[model samples]
Structures are given as structure tokens and as C-alpha cells.
Target chain A: MKDRSGSVLRLAQPVRLWVQRFTFLLLLATAAGLMLLGKADTVIVERIRVEMTDAVAPVLDALSRPIGVANDLIEHGRNVYGLALENRTLREENARLMQWQAVARQLEAENAVLRNLTGFVPETAATEVSARVIGASGGAYVRSVLVAAGARHGVRKGQAAVAGAGLAGRVTEVGDRSARVLLITDLNSRIPVVVESSRDQAILAGDNSDRPRLDYLRANARVSPGDRVVTSGIGGIFPPGIPVGVVVGTDGGLRVQPPIDWDRLEFLRLVDFGLGGPLRGQGGAGDPGGRP
Target chain B: MTPAGGTIAHRVDAAAREATPAVLTLVLILLDVVPLRLPEFAVITPSFALMSVYYWTMYRAELMPAPVVLALGVFQDIVGGGPLGVGAFVLLATHGAVLTQRRVLMRRPFAVGWVGFVGVALAAFTLTWVIMAVLHLALFNPLAAGMQYVMTVALYPPVAWLLLAVHRSWVQAR
Candidate 1:
């Protein structure tokens, strides 16, 4: 009986090994198959991704706080170290800004007069919801940040998120109390941008880099280095004239150097232009030639 | 205590013992997303989950099976916002490759295992780049993946040390 049982066990060992090998290969195949399915970017896969993010968010939030506090402390130390030099620079800048404020008021009056003459309708002021950033990405695959405010705080999808410097990103995914801001440097992001100085339109396309490239410029589109890039509002996804970045690099491969200090991000302001998009309802195309 | 209650308690303890690999893998995955607020920690950090999966499977192949590794990989991808199934393919491939060479690896010294991990890291990163590049139909910048692979390799020793401690404390004797 013992000899028979030993032979049975010996036979079972090979079967177990075979099963293990089969399962491993099967999993690999499943993974490849799932990758193919994900290519379509269907609603189900997106929902799953969002749900997964939501599930993992709290644990990550708790884990990230201590690190964030340490980061803030280091930044504070740096600021204190540079306080003297920074204060003098700020004082000079403030004085210069005051003079510019006077000029701006004068220009405003002249612009209002011209607007009255031309019967121009100014854009409505944008409403905003301020929120703290909960998560910032460090991977090249996706450039995004998660904000604590979501639908609960009036943070809607497709709204522009801005930092102190310039346009940060757009709200792409929103849960109950959190939303993901796909930064302008993400490979998938394409912001309809215009050179604020020349008004030459182009698309700002991110290629998983710190600087994004410009696309779709007209022939002889007189572009030069250091020109400002702003949203064109052609797609109606973003409002016009939102400061994006500045053109940088040499003649051939010009890129927009965004004003974002990628090292430090704490809070963002989400601007919800009530109309949301041009296709949504109001046809405010900014067409001066249309019948008024 | 009654004998039946004692037996039930003993079974629960045994079950918890069995779940250590899965639990640790899950925690490592949670750590995967904990954004370190350093500029250098930018976008691609070390693969803590991968290290743990590889270590646990190498040491206790029966306990850390292919299904568990596959599940952990999928869970990590889901949470990490990685390309779906990419984790599974890479991890399962790693598991299969290691399992085949387990006899040779188990006989080797600590230095050999560490050296072996470098090759594994390379394969994992290369596979990731290929999968993503093919999926996107564009060439991905290898710089990030290369950095990630280096970090993963750098981080392995400490992570392996911790896992060894856990194994010694909880898993080795019984």
C-alpha cells in the first residue's frame, strides 16, 4: 500500500509542475490580450482605471503626507536662505509693477473706448474652485496630478487648472471628491495655443517631455524665440488667452517652456467657464463678423 | 478553551500565515503610488512590487504561485495607472524564467542573486518599452525606462534585506 501511494505521489508531482507552467503562460497571454483590448480606450476600461485609482487613493494620500511635509520644510528652508536677495528683487519688481498698473489702466480706458466704437462684447468672468493637490505624477507615461476637489467642489471635467505661474493642465477624470489633471506635458495632451504676441495659431503637443512642441503653424508664420503661447479657444475646451508658456529652443524644433515649477505644486485653481464648451450650448465663437 | 475553538483558532492562524505573500505584495503596490515629493523621484521610481514578487517567488515558489504573481501584477497596474496587462506579461514572464532556473539560482550565493536581478530588471524594462511603443505606434523615450531600471536595481538590496528579515522571522521555520 505504501509503495502504491509513493508511485501515485510521484505521478502527481509532474502534473503539478505541468499545471504551474500552463498557468504561467496562460497569465502572460491574458496580459497581452488585455493590452490589446485596452487600445480601444473604451468607457469600461476607463471606468475600471478610475475605480482602481479611487480605491488606491486614500492609502496613497496617507502615505504621501509625511513626504509632502518634508518637501515643504525643505522649500521653506531654501526660501529663508534666499530671503534677503528675494525681498530686494520683489521690492524692485513691485515698483516696476506699479508703473505698469498705471499704463494698464490707461490702456484699459482706451480699449473700452475702442470696444464701444466697435460694439465689442467682452467675455464673462470665469468662476473658479480652489483645491489642494493630493497627488503628482513622476512617471513619463502620464503627466497628471490629482486634486482633492472634484464634482463635490464644482471641479468638472475639461475645466482648466492653473497654478500661480501659468496654465497647469485640464481635469480629465473626476471621482466623488477627487479629479486628475492631465498636465500639458503628457503625451496625449494637445492644447490649442496661439502666440500671444504674433497671434499666430498652433497646437501645443506634449511628447512626454518637460517642453512641448508646436504643431500646425501656417507657412511663413513669423515665429521667433521668447514669444508667449496662450490658448486659442478654437476648440472651446480652454478659454482664450490663458497664458500657457513661452516659445524656446532654435529654429527647427521650437518648444514651449511652460512656467510651471515642476518641483513644487501645492494648490491649483479650476476655472469652470459655465458654458463649458462651444458645442455644448452657446455659440460664442468670438466672430466679430457675425450679425449682432 | 474548548478543543473545537482551539482548533478553529489554529486554522485561522494557519490561513493568515498562508496569506503573507499576497498581503506583502499588496502593501508594496500601495507604496508604488505614494508620491515621493522629490524632484529626483520624478515619474519613474523603483519597482518595489517587482522586487518583492521576485524575492518571494524565488524563496517560496509553492507559496508564491504564478496566479498570485499575476494577480499582484494586475493589481499594481490598476493602481499605478500602468498599461493594462503589461504588468501581468512582464511579471509572469519573470516568474516563468526564474522558476525554470530556480535550481541554479537557489544554489548561487547572494551576489549571484543580486547580479541575476540586474538582468531581470533589464528584461522587465525592455519588455515594458516594447509593449508601450508597440501599443502607441511610436518610439518611446528609453531614458525614463533606463532610469527606472537603474533605480529598481539600486533599491533591490534593501528591499531584499527586509524581505529576508520577514522570511526569517515568520516563514522560515514553519
Candidate 2:
């Protein structure tokens, strides 16, 4: 009986080891299989992700307030140190600006007279909401920012988000107290844009890079480096004439140096342009005859 | 042995064994998500999570099971915005590689084991690059990927030490 028991014990050891190893391998196989199969329908996943992001945006915003304050304090100290020289420069610029302001008033009077003669009326500006950027979705992929204001603050999906400088991107996902703004640098982002100097239309395409590329530019388009780019309002997604970026010439094509510094994004403005209105039939607000 | 004492000992041994693998899996997941940016070495970003997976497989294969490692890889895939099985395949192969050389690695000193880890990480990263290239039909930029690998490799030593400390504490406490 003792000899038989010893042999059985030795056999059981290997059996147990094999079972453990097999079980582990099986689990890994299942996880991989699930990931591949589960991610097949990204549209549904993206919807859910947007909703979740909106829900958490406000909480993140509250938490980030202290960091924002600290940054502002440091910036203020640096600005104060250079205030004297800056004031001197600003005084000269102010005098130059006053001279230009008088010329601008005269041009505006002349332009209004021309508009009256042409029966043209300017569209009223839309309501605006100011929001603070609370968190950043920093990773190898997915360039998104979370802002404090959301549905409660009249922030809606597809609203044009901007910073102090110019157009940032559109709000793709919104929540009750927060929202996620997809930056123009994301691979999936595309915008209808026009060259400010030449009036040539082109599509701005993001390829997960800091500077986005301008596609479909006409061969004879008179675009040059340092020319400003602005939204053309072709798709009705964004309002017309929002400053987008400056054109930079690349080896292969033209790139846009976005007006908003994506890396150091802190605050954003969501223009409540009342896009869900009779603006579709009215054509683009900025266009003279409401024609494409 | 008395029946009551034997049962208690058996229960304690099973519980201890179960806890080891669970703890290691949690550590691996945590390392995968925490963003550690080093601006000085612009080209190379190290992945600490990959190192953890490699070390645990070599040191305590029984505790760091293949399946958990695979699951971790899949989670990384979803988070990294790539095809789901990419991380899974890379991690599965890495664990398998370590398993094949388990006996030799177990007896080696820390430095030899770390060097072995670097080799394993390089292989895993290369495999992932190939898979991505095939899927996208574009040549994966070696410089961009190499920078990430360098960062991940640089981060391995401190993370490995931290994992070791945690394991020791858990084992002693148990």
C-alpha cells in the first residue's frame, strides 16, 4: 500500500503543474480574442467613451483648479519683472494703434454705406461661453481636452471651441458639467479652411502631428508661407472666418501652424453660434450673396 | 500530522499561492497606465510595465501566469488606440520566451536578468512594430519606436526594484 501511494503522489505533482500552466494559457487566449472581437465596432465604443468623458469632465475641472492657480501666480511674477520695458514698448504701439483706429473707423463707415446700398445686413453674433481646461488626455494617441463648462453652461456638441488666439477645434462630446474638445491635431480631425490672403479653399487634415497638413490646394493657388488660414464654413460644422492657423510650407505639402498652442492648452471658449437655426438656407453668414 | 493542523496548513498554503499571482497582475496593470515623461531623452521613452511583466515571468512564472499577462496586453491595446491583439501577442510571446529560459534566468544575478529583460523588450517591441506595419501597410518609423523603447528600457531598473520590494513585503506579511 505504501509503495502504491508514493507512485500516485509523484504522478499528481506533474498533473497539477500541467493543469496550472494550461489554465493560464487559456485565460490569455480568451483576453486576446475578446479584445480583437470586442473592438470591431468602434462607433459604439466611441459614443460610450464620449459620454463617460463628459460625465467626468467637471470633476476633473474642479481638481485642476489649484494647478491652474499656481501656474497663473508664477506667470504673473514673471510678467511683473518685465513690466517696465513692456510698458514702454506698449506706449509706442498704442500711439500707432490709435492712428490705425481712426483709419479703420473711416473704412467701416464707407463699408456700411456700401452694404446699405447693396441691401446687406450683418448676422448677429452668437452667445459665447468661457470654460477652463481641467484635464488633458495625454497619450501616444487621442489628443483631447476636458473643459469645466458643459450642458449646464449651454455647451453643446459641435460647438466651435477657441482659445484667446484663434480656432482650436469643435466640441465633439458634451456632459452636464464638462465636455471633451477634440484638438485639431488628432488623426481623425478635418476642417474646411480658406487661405486668408489668396481666398483659396482647402481641407485641413490632422495626422497625429503638431502641424496639420492642408490637402486639395489648387496648383495655381497663390498661397505662400506665413499666410493666415481661417474656417471657410463649407460644411456648416464651424462658423465662418474663425482664425485657424498660419500656413507653413513643408517638403511634401503645406502644414498649418495652429493658432492655439495644443501642448500648453489651458483655457477655451465655446461659441454658442446658434448653429441649429435657419442658417443653412441663409448660406454662410460671412458670404455676400449666401452662395457657395 | 494531526488532521486539524494539516487542514489549516493546507488552507494557508493555497491562500498564499493564490495571493502572489493576483498581486503581480495588479502591479503590472498599474505600471502600464501611469504616464512618466522624460523630456531630456526626447527620442527614447521607457515602458516600465513591459519590464514588470518580463521580470515576474522569469522570477516567479507560477505566480505570474501567461493568461493574466495576455489580458494586460489587451488592455494596453485598447488604451494605446491600436488593434486589440497587438499587445496580447507581444506579451504572450514575451512570457513564453521567459518560460523557455526560466531555469537559467532564475539562478542569474540582477544584472544578467536585466540584460535579458532588455533583449526580451526589444523583441516584443519589434514584433509589435511589424504587426502594426502589416496592418497599416506603411513602414513604421524606427526612430519614433526606438525612442519609446529607449525610454522603457531606462525605466526598468527602478521599477524592477520596486516590484521586488513589494513581493518581499507581501510574502513576509503573508
Off by over 4 Å in 1: A1-10, A109-119, A250-252, A277-292, B1-6, B171-174
**Candidate 2 segments exceeding 4 Å error:** A1-43, A47-142, A145-156, A173-180, A270-272, A277-292, B1-48, B55-103, B134-140, B170-172
Best by DockQ: 1
Q: Best by TM-score, which number?
A: 1
Candidate 1, residues B52-144, lDDT tens digits: the string is 878877777777888888888887776665667888788888888778777788778877888888887788788878877887677878888
Tens digits of per-residue lDDT for model 2 on B1-174? 112455777777656755665556544543333222223221233555577678778876666677677766755554333455767777788888888887887897888888888888889889877866664455645766776787677778888887788667664344
TM-score of chain A, model number 1: 0.86
Clashes per model (N, Cα, C within 3 A): 2, 10
Candidate 1 chain A weakest ten by summed lDDT? A278-287
